[model samples]
Target chain A: MVAKTRGMKIVHSIEVLQHMLNRDERIGRTVGFVPTMGFLHEGHLALVEQARTQNDLVVMSIFVNPAQFGPGEDFEAYPRDIERDSRLAAEAGVDVLFMPTPEEMYPQDGGIRILPGPQATALCGASRPGHFDGVLKVILKLFNIVDPDRAYFGMKDAQQLAIIETFVRDYNLRTAIVRVPTVREPDGLAKSSRNVNLSEKEREEAPVIQQALQKGAALFHTGASAEQVEKEVAQYITEHSSGRIDYVSLLAYPELTTSSETSREWILACAVKFEKTRLIDNSILSVFSKEFPTQ
Target chain B: MVAKTRGMKIVHSIEVLQHMLNRDERIGRTVGFVPTMGFLHEGHLALVEQARTQNDLVVMSIFVNPAQFGPGEDFEAYPRDIERDSRLAAEAGVDVLFMPTPEEMYPQDGGIRILPGPQATALCGASRPGHFDGVLKVILKLFNIVDPDRAYFGMKDAQQLAIIETFVRDYNLRTAIVRVPTVREPDGLAKSSRNVNLSEKEREEAPVIQQALQKGAALFHTGASAEQVEKEVAQYITEHSSGRIDYVSLLAYPELTTSSETSREWILACAVKFEKTRLIDNSILSVFSKEFPTQ
Candidate 1:
């Protein structure tokens, strides 16, 4: 169904989204895509803002992809507010809001999976198995349907940004993956859909996720070993937050592997369980690449 | 380097191919692609022919992807005759020959892998581990480089054709996968580049591969169970050929999974090892889909 707002067109089916994209392509319009799982956080908005700045038409997809959620995970409880999300998207300069049903995304026989490679095996991958595969599969579906010139993702999920970059490079997927810096609050907590799941007490403690990463980034900048940076982040999270620690990892940036490359950046990432909610955050541990040639 | 003959233009880089394809797209030209490893056979020509007929511009890529071969496999020994292949492709009505080096296809820091799921775990996938993953990875690279409206592949490698279809469906790949029928010699031997590796004795007996598939298809048409069809095919290959049997599998078409849908076709496939060389063949076992309701 085609539902219209002041600036944004809300499209529900893949057929309609593809049609709109095809017409846009024909008319020489550069479409930018921002894919999200509803909730409409500042991190997602930052992605949309980047998309809007870079392209003629900005398309946002708000589907809580079930394929990305693990068994016993919060797929059922995953926060979704389409009405609020649509209004936020419209206000944020999104041209088309694609909200597809799971059936529309999946086929009848069984669902499709975009299995991740070596890059998807570390950090969050360990605790949340098959999470990235499901993410990549649905994102690929969105990319094909929207056929955007550029797709935006927050670097908050630095591993995700890296995996998406690798997927685009590996699969020769045409979309340019644009990474927006992680959007955070004044206290430095990373904006997330799961943030809503945090209790008031957990919310106050969750900034420790970001504080730990910032601390690790500071340590990495001081020429500490990746192992040392990871240990300090883990220790800080365990001590400061009222949360059970899941993982504290330092990885080769974007590759998300334990391996290191001398001339590249690393990501210091951590995930912690805040009561029933899990919060994650990361920072560029170091910039030894050409981006920081002076370093 | 640009090599030209009549309507055929041969380009040596992915950049040039993409540029040409983009220019073609800008002018509203439809592109159809056929990707093959060099040592062009009648089967490859059939793919090119289909591609040429279906689209305004037909691009044929000849790169014997090293990624698809296992450690001891024929990556080094895989046949290559660029002059012969180029001539064949041009004669087959190919508009562009996008031949690239192996280095161009793979990255230095470990290449991209399109890992196959349940559909890839059976048939040839069992004997040749990581083969379909490589096939899909390269094909995806080619699809990205070419950006074809439709890409042609032969059903002789039914597993490959099925996997590609599944890949396209799974990944939401933009290019349509066109399956050409298995092309065979007068005696029913399916054309293959590796046929050169077959000994004269093996060559004579290789037709049994297709003959067995023909027998299997005949049995399948008679309402035989998938298991029975596989058994007869395996028995015929074992009895007649000098080759050691790798596998004789019959599974749901375009899925290659054992789980079948009522409105789907099955594929009877077999692979045999003739000394160091391997040969494969298949037939559409049955069709009960709505598309073939009369059948």
Candidate 2:
């Protein structure tokens, strides 16, 4: 049956999804997937829309992958609106909506861990022990289950995006990885479902995250050293925002390595805590050499 | 073209395989796979015959998986006879003889590392740091590429088999793992292509590995404690055989945990060194109360 704009199939089990996918006869149809935690925002919608435009079949999975979340790290508090997500995905012309629960995604007594090496362990991997392992495991699971021709991920989660790319390359996954630009709010705050949980005061201050990233990006253009750029960004966020600065540093883009000179591809990433919510943002920073005209 | 014996078609790449296994087609055929490193032997052929009887289409992959070998390991020295292997496989009714080069299998740069966790660090995992990681990586790649209904593994590599099972369970792989009993020589030496490296004297002493495991199994049958069984096995191999004992122990089957009293399922495993060659062997030892005649 064709999934209309309003009603679509929601598969909770990997087996069920595989069975359904196996029944579809369109051999040449290019499949696109957008894997997400249950809550949906305009940023997620943009990803779905991009997938819809690029692929014959668009699959949007709303799984709050438990593996990606650290213990006492907003797993339970993570915003989720499946009904609204379904409506939005349908409006975006999604063909399938995979909504697997933690139990459905992770089998009982299953201890298989996929560790994305150095790339995972540098930035977020340093802070979280098994974080990227969880991310890689779930993403690999989702990729296998969906068997998409192309998969889309937002650049907002720059480290995660990079790790996924490495996983696909290392494993020789057949799916193409399409990275979309980060979607932001009018006030410069990155659009996230978690932003909905912010109190009025925290919400007002959330814009400072984007502003700090912008400032870091600007300083990088002035041939500033990575250390100098980081100092300025951290100071700006501390002075203007009510949040506690978790970390602010300029590191190599995709590689996530700490580099001094603004050459080739690099990123200025920062994380800040506002009461209970932790927000993160990053921007590409590089020298405007022949290799990278826009940088 | 239909395979003369089973009417199954031979396919090489993922595209060809998936073309045959189209979504709308009725997959009435049972697909069984035997992934190998070419240089086919009686042991590898035995696995193929088992697959032939158990499945409608028997796919035998002859790829010397580079991911499984260390930098100094004999990946290049590993024997290969593809033309001869193909003839033998076809004689054994293999539907597809998948022969892929190292380049074809791992097209990407060798920069990235895929790490399978803690379970990989126990026993052999300790001996070979990233050995099992390479095995798991290549096997997972083959599993995804083949997408077989059932995959066959010989029991000769007991630890490797256990790791494969762990991978399938942990990754929620849909393929069924069909483990075959280890094929052996008349003198009790387990058949391995690597056995070719053994000199005449080493070859004669090779049977000692099997003898140690059998002795350990006998001890378990006599209601001996795991510790006692291990000591007896190690002592016997050391005193009787010209080969040096690498390891000998009675442990929990599959889990590899050391045990004193033989439980429901136990593994009497041993590894020995004959000159420069290393040989390993194990047998399942099951202990049942006298009251339970069935067990």
Candidate 3:
């Protein structure tokens, strides 16, 4: 046996991790998992914290999935600081840090993928054609490898979290999901790895993405039309930030499907391209007619 | 607690089944599962035999999955004899029989599914679109519900077995798959659920499907070209049986992909349209070169 790093074991291969997990499972020790791309931040650590609180063991997987990135996407230039990530994860009380090579994860021609249904393919999937397919596929792989009782995801990517919830419900998977609130900087910028790519000026401008969503959400509570609120959110982000607006969508929360019913949850989601870095943020708003008063 | 039926317990809800499984798992009892569409025959019981020998507990789920059947297909008319199946299962040493209502299994819409890649969509999947999607989706649900150490599938549906094997491998699922050899009749007819739809004459003629594949295998071993083997197989089945040939295909085995390499494994598969019913059979061949001279 090797010396543990700060009471945390760093496993390189899936086989080693699974073997370790099998022993944990045999002893009936509950496992909680936090899956993330490398370059860990507070948002990712929030998920780890939730997992750490709930289970006997906490496993964090750092894999920059190539399948999720499209051509001209940042797969090549995606930030990688494995040593830093390891240190942070260890500090955050992660028990096992799983780091698998892409070749080991994907032995075949990467053809084996989980195709998302209409809900998963609505917002983010619309822009990135097969993005959720890769996300769901990788999550399935991670869940199998870790055999965690509960897995954590930050609500920063509410759409991704929703898709994963839907997949679990659909497949009747054993792994339960715990959605952690998004971790944000004091300036209100949602923590993301892509933030490192931001210029100093862009960093100051980034919080407007969330502010615009909040603006739309406030209007939504005041009984503004979806189209009107969407227009205002888009205009607000475009006007306040140096970033070009990718989209500011007002979608039904969780379902993400369009519904004429005003008595459902909603999300004001936005994406922006600030120089070389693209960032996404969203706010979940309960605008059910009974919950909010008309202006 | 309900009195056990012949030392076997039958469960109707997933909640109850999972509770029982959780209790059993706590005691370190290894579960073996055999998922099947009802109207249990020797073929299904053969799977149970394999399961019984290997595991401390055997669970046989009899669910005639509605999602798997197409609009024009026999979803409504599919043979189901739950009482007979239960009796047969008990006789075959099944410890638990899980039979869930469609509403419970698919509470929402039947839209949730596991889609297959190119390999699953090749031969049988081509003829029946979304069939394997439904097949895979149900199996995934069952796997989660059962959480079995091992699961069994008959080799009669080699394509289904292959697709499922790929899914298990790709997802790194906990359950290991046991590929049981096809249970055949004395006359060489592969047992299938659709066999009940066969007329007496059709039954006699159905064995030719297997015989034709064997003939093709013989010809293939004798250094006949793919064209020659395929033509002879199709011709032999057509001439000997009242059934019209649906497709008589010779393809590389396991991978099911095209290969010029003669050293690899191969499968001579055929599907025949017997009046209203379609039956399939295959023969695995290993013909690398002209190493063996004709007698």
Candidate 4:
């Protein structure tokens, strides 16, 4: 079935999506894709906007991929609002919206698994095992179904961005991964689907995750050891917010390795669990640099 | 480095192969690919020949893919003669022969793995755990680099072909999988790279594997149960050849699932160990059919 509004087409089947994309390719149209677990926010729109500006066609897929969520994680509790998401996507100039069911996305018991190497061992990956593997699985399927020239991802999930980039490079995928900076609120809280789960006070306190990471970034620029920066960030978050520290880690930026060296790029990343939600934020900085590159 | 002979281009790197294929695609040429572990035989040549006839360009990859080999499973002793393979490829009308070194193919510790499901629980997968996972890893890399419109596989690797088909369908890969029949020697032995490891006496006995499979197929047509077919095949191999029975099994075709009923198509397959080599063969048969489908 196809639903249309403001000339934007919403498709729910892989066959229909591929049929449309095949026609687009035959006519020499370049596609830019943005994949999301649907709950419309400014951060996702930013990715859509980039896709719109860069290609002849912009395709966005809203799939709450269950494969990526671990047991006791937020798979069931994850927010999904297709109606709002479609409206936001149409407003952002998305040409086609692919909203596939879990059954449609995974029709069989797929024996193949796309696992992360050591690069996934730290940061968010350290806490969320098989999370990036599920991410890579859905992303790979989306890339194939859409056959996009380029795909868009947000820097909010910095570890995910790194893993996807590595997956693309290692697999020799034709789709170029375009990283969009994390979108934030006036109070500097990173926009996320899970933000809706936060209580009013927790929402007010969530911005401290970012604040703590900035402090860690500053410490890193002063040539702080990775361990020291992590400790300082953890202490800051514990002291400043009504949130428990999940993890605060400063490691080699994309490689996500634990090294004592302060000679290269580093990612100051943290996760804090409020009463109802866990929020993650990160800042990438080069050694001795005054600026937070991702902030 | 590019080595050319009789219009066949031999490429040693992924970048160079992609560059050449990109040029060909820009001008709108359909590519057909055959990926093989080298030491070419009539079976590989047959795949290349089909690719030649079907597409404007034919690409063949000869990578032994160490990942697919288990410990003590001939990773080091696996045969390789690229010079001879290239000559055969040229004679068989191959357009590009891609031969990459192990280091070039692996490059890094790839965290990604492609696994098999229940379909791989029997046959070759039962005897060799993680074998198909390694096969998929290399095949995916090759498919990405080649980006062929159609990729060819032999039915001699019936289980592998089935798993790859499932992978393609599950992932929605753009490439079409072309199944080529298994090529065989005059005595009905399936041509294999490991056939070289067989002694002269073992070589003479290898064809009995195929013969026992045919006999099993005949038993299956007489409304025999899967268990009965398997028992008869095992007995025949043990009685006729000096080879030891590795396994003799009957399973639902492609799915490789066991069922007591004999109403549909089934694969009667067997493996035998003769001194230095293990040989496998199979025949697909419908219930009460008088013919061995693959023979």
RMSD of each: 3.7, 4.6, 2.6, 3.5
In the predicted model 2, the residue pairs found to clash are A253-A266, B67-B134, B226-B260
Predict model 1's lDDT versus the native.
0.80
Model 3 complex DockQ against the native: 0.53
Per-residue lDDT over A124-172 for candidate 3, one digit per residue giving the tens place of the 0 to 100 score: 7778887887788899889988878899999888888888998898788
> Model 4, DockQ value?
0.52
**Residue B158's lDDT in candidate 1:** 78
Clashing pairs in 3: none
Pick the DockQ winner.
3
- Report the lDDT tens digits of candidate 1 across residue range B1-295: 6789767999988777777777325466788888888799999988887777779888888888888999999898888898888888888899898888877766543333457777778888887888887887788778777877898888888778877887787667778988899888999998999999988898999999888888888777777676787889899989997888888887777766665556368777888998868888877855742232221
Interface RMSDs of all predictions?
A: 3.3, 3.5, 2.8, 2.9
lDDT of each: 0.80, 0.76, 0.84, 0.83
Off by over 4 Å in 2: A1-5, A23-26, A259-264, A285-295, B1-31, B54-59, B70-77, B81-83, B93-123, B259-264, B287-295
Rank the models by TM-score, top first.
Answer: 3, 4, 1, 2
- Which scores greater on TM-score, model 2 or model 4? 4
What CAPRI grade goes to candidate 2? acceptable
DockQ of each: 0.40, 0.34, 0.53, 0.52
